[model samples]
Each structure stands twice: as C-alpha cells, then as structure tokens.
Target: MALSEREQQVLRDLESQLHQEDPGLADTMDSRTTGPLRLSPRHIGAGVALVLVGMSLVVGGVVVRNSVISILLGVVGFGMAVWGVTLALTRVEAGGGPGSSRRPSRRSSFMDRQSQRWDRRRGSQG
Candidate 1:
C-alpha cells in the first residue's frame, strides 16, 4: 500500500515534533532498519538454481532405475521451489518502514506499567 502525499507530510511533521522534543532519541533512531523479508534477486536466483539441480538429480535417478533416489530428489526439488516462491512473494519491513511510527497500543502501555511495577517491587525488596 502506498501513502498519499498528505499522509506522508503528516508523518514528517510528527517526526519533526518528535525530534524537537527528544533530540537524543532522534539521534538514536537515525539508523535505517532493514525492511521486511524480501527476496533479493540473488536469493531468487540461488533458489531457482537449487530447484533446477534437484530436478536434474531426480531425472538422473530415474534414468538409473532407482526409485528411492528419484523420490528423494523430487521431494527436494519441490521443497526448494516452494521455498523460492515463498521468499519471492513474502515481504516484511523493519523499523523506519511504513506504519512503524505509530504509538504503542493500550496493551503495550499496560505491559510497560507492569514492568515498572515489577522493577519497583524488586528494588524495594532488595
């Protein structure tokens, strides 16, 4: 999904506000996190090559009249092809990507409160 120009501007404005309020945090967040799982051309190529090799292996086994070997090669080829397709189709974005700038939800707030309480309790006991 692509963001509209207005939405992009809003995000930029929010980021500026954040930077002004917390320069230290802003500096810490300057790193570009890797985007989601995307199959690079290299990975796709490697996967395709693997599938091809496996298929060839299966064909060779069949030519040699070895049922067990043929079956094993076929399974390997299928698995490799599936893995390649999955890698190519699935994409995951890391931090700094779209929708990553949103504030934490209520559940996250609750978890933070609970963690703080636990820390306080431990400190008092100690």
Candidate 2:
C-alpha cells in the first residue's frame, strides 16, 4: 500500500531533522530501497519463454523419441532465461558509488564527539 500524505509528511520531517544533524546521511540512503521491484514485464516474458522452450523440447522429444535429453535441455534453458530476467529487474548498485561520501558504519562518530566535548568540559572544570 502507498503511504498516506500524513505519513509521508512525518517521514519527510524526520528525514529533515536527520539531515540537519548529519550533513551527508541522506546520501547514504538508497532511493529505491522502498520502491517496488517492477519485474512484471520481464517476469512474464521469462515465464512465457520458459513455457515455450519446455513445450518445444517436449514436442521435439516426442518426434525424436528421446524424452530424457530433451527434458534436460529444456529445463536448463528455462532456468537460465528466468535467471536472466530476474537479473535484469534488479538494480546494479544499491547505495552511492565510490565517489559518494559514506559515513563509517563502525565509527561511533556521534558518541565519540559528545564524549570528547564532555572530557573538555570536565578538564576545564578541574
């Protein structure tokens, strides 16, 4: 289901706050993370191609009177076509590429900064 206007507003507000606090955090988020895969056309085409290839193999087997090899080849072709179609629908890279600035996931940058500030205050107090 689609997000309601109010829900969208809330999300935007939260994102705005995040951006205000962290300059480059929004760049880390993938725009397509929430969107649909949109694989309908490719999926349908793959299904139809699979069916056709399998049917052809079956018919060829009947003609040649060799069911085993025909079934195997057809199954392989169908699997490959379906895999290709699935790959086509998927995106290449998720987040921003090499040039894109990324915050260190393991770095406790925020907490470390706050702690440093606290240490400075404690030193000054002493």
Candidate 3:
C-alpha cells in the first residue's frame, strides 16, 4: 500500500531527525545503502581459497580423463581467479564522498574511446 502524503512527510522528518541526532549511525546506514561492497582482507583471502579449490577441481577432472568436466572446471577456476584478483585490487568510493575533486585521467581504453565518440556524435546531432 502507498504511504499517505502526511505519512511520507513524517517519515522524512524522522529521517532528518535521525541524521541530526546520531551522525555516526546515519553515516553507517548511508554507507550500507549507497557504498560499494567493501571487501576486507579476510574476504579476499576467502576468494583466493575458492580459486584454489576450483583449480583442484579442474586438476581432478583432468586426472579422470573427462574432457568436458575438465574444460568446465578449468573455466570456473579461471573465472574465480579473476574474481579474486578484482577483489584484491578494486578501490570503490562513493561519488563525491571524499577525494572526489581529482581530475579524470586522460588515458582511455579502446572501448572508452569508442563510447566517447558515440556520445559526442549523439550530442552534436541533438
């Protein structure tokens, strides 16, 4: 059921009061809702362990001389390894949260360059 207009206003007022009363709790709640998944060192370690288990599965499949299973397991292992690396290295920050004043880097990948070109074309036409 939709909230009535008065109920909506009351909810907004409560939220504003919450921010004013306990800023730390507000920040934690905001981070949980708006922030990226902040993986800890232990989480990254678990991801590495998962990659190792996937590799072992691939090796066992190969020993059993199952081509299909071996290929599938190998692919899974590769994906897990890539995921672990990403978890280890990725730095996620909320937009305009902190240190957001830095200028964008000029380096552009092939896809980035193509996307920029497409955007410019659309902008000029419009």
Candidate 4:
C-alpha cells in the first residue's frame, strides 16, 4: 500500500529528527545507501580476459615438446589464472575509496560497545 501524503510527511520529519539526534544511527539504518563492497564490470571483464589467456598458455605449454619451456609456461599460466580469479572476485568500495574521511557508522560503534562489555565481563570473572 502506498503511504498517504500525511504519513510521508510524518516519516520525513521523523527521519530528519533521527539524523539530527544520531547521524551515525541514521546512516546505519538508511537502506538507500549502498554498502562498502560493489561489483565493477571493468574488473570482471579484465579478470575474465586474464583467466582465458592464462588457460590458453597452460594448454600451449602442454602441447609444446620442450620440457623446460613447458614447465615454465605451465607455471606462468597457473599464476596468471590465479591472479585473474582474484581480480574477478575482488569488489570496489561504494563511497570514497579506501581511507575516506567519513565517520564510522553505528554498526562499528555497536560492535565496540559489545567488545567492551565482553572485556569487562571477562575481567570480572577472572
């Protein structure tokens, strides 16, 4: 069901108040924002290409008659394939790349609070 205009206004007001009171919490709760890890088409394409080239090199190494050259080619091919797979699986950050100036969200703060509680409990028990 669609929200009525009055309900939408109320929600907006509530959201604004939340942001004003606790920006970290608001950010954490906001579903509109993207997460840290995002897939990159460019990276996927490059990784796939590398994997294919690596596989071909391995095949070529197998077909070659020379033992030393075949071994070298095979090793190189394996390395390339591994690198390609790693690249393909890697994801880019959503916001301003790594080491951005953005404040830590409520999630981290919550985790920190939990850790602190755990530590205190441990100290008490010990």
**Which candidate achieves the best TM-score against the true structure?**
4
In model 1, which residue pairs have backbone atoms overlapping below 3 Å?
36-92, 36-93, 37-92
Predicted structure 4: clash tally:
0
lDDT of 1 by residue, 3-111 (tens): 9999999999998998999988877676334234444555456667766765676566577667787777777767766776665554443322245466445657888
CA-lDDT, candidates in order: 0.68, 0.63, 0.71, 0.85
Model 4: how far residue 5 lies from native, Å: 32
Sequence-dependent TM-score of model 1: 0.36
Instruction: Write one digit per residue (lDDT tens) for candidate 2, span 14-109.
Output: 989887888566655644455434445444566666666656655565566466876676666666656655544544333232343454432557
Judged by lDDT relative to the true structure, which candidate is superior, 3 or 4?
Answer: 4
Question: Which wins on lDDT, candidate 1 or candidate 2?
Answer: 1
- Provide the clashing-pair count of each candidate structure: 3, 0, 0, 0
- Candidate 2 regions off by >4 Å? 1-9, 12-64, 94-126
- Pairs in steric clash, model 3: none
TM-score for each candidate, following the candidate numbering: 0.36, 0.31, 0.37, 0.49
lDDT of 2: 0.63
Query: In model 3, where do residues sit more than 4 Å from their true spots?
Result: 1-39, 92-126
What's the C-alpha lDDT at position 49 in model 2?
67
Candidate 2 local lDDT, residue 22: 81
Residue-wise C-alpha lDDT for candidate 3, range 1-126, written one tens digit per residue: 999999999999998999999999988898878856554555467677776776777677677667887788778777777776766655545333234445333333555898999999999999
Could you give the candidate ranking by lDDT, starting with the highest? Answer: 4, 3, 1, 2
